[model samples]
Target: MLYIFQDETTSTVAPARLYKALTIDGDTIIPKVIPGFRTVEIVEGNGGPGTIKKLTFEEGQHIYVTYALHIYNL
Candidate 1:
């Protein structure tokens, strides 16, 4: 079985800034703002297609998330 999810939102920030925050600087920023996230590190690949990131949460947290992001140019 397979599942996919999508979400859309509106923001007043410029597209470039938003992209930078979410993609370019996310590893550094997310763990700081979001509780339970102990660290977000790139386990493999450069910051491009096929990148695999490991997100380790604080101890006792029930969720363990890992992302293998395949980015493409639109």
Candidate 2:
């Protein structure tokens, strides 16, 4: 069985800053802040929409992430 999880939160940070941190700098930031995360590698694409990244943990567990971006005009 496959499960999908989604979450939403409000932040005081600007959207552009948040986006850069999560997408551009995440590989460096995630391992430092998140325990058990060994490294994050881009397995495919150029870190854009549809890009796939692999997160390897200290215990040899791996998680694959595919990015999808949604833009809304306000």
What's model 1's overall lDDT? Answer: 0.86
List model 1 lDDT by residue over 1-74, tens digit each.
33465679999999999999999999999999999898999899897888989999998886677778864455
Worst 10 residues of 2 by lDDT: 64-73
Per model, state how many residue pairs clash.
Answer: 0, 0
Residue 34, model 2: Cα distance from true site in angstroms: 0.9
Q: Model 1 segments beyond 4 Å from truth?
A: 1-3, 72-74
TM-score, predicted candidate 1 vs. hidden true structure: 0.81
Best by lDDT: 1
Clashing residue pairs for model 2: none
Candidate 2 wrong stretches, greater than 4 Å: 1-3, 59-74
Q: Write the per-residue lDDT of candidate 2 for residues 1-74, one digit (tens) a residue.
A: 34556679999999999989987999999999999888888878787766667777776555544444333344
Q: Which residue window of length 10 is worst by lDDT in model 1?
A: 65-74
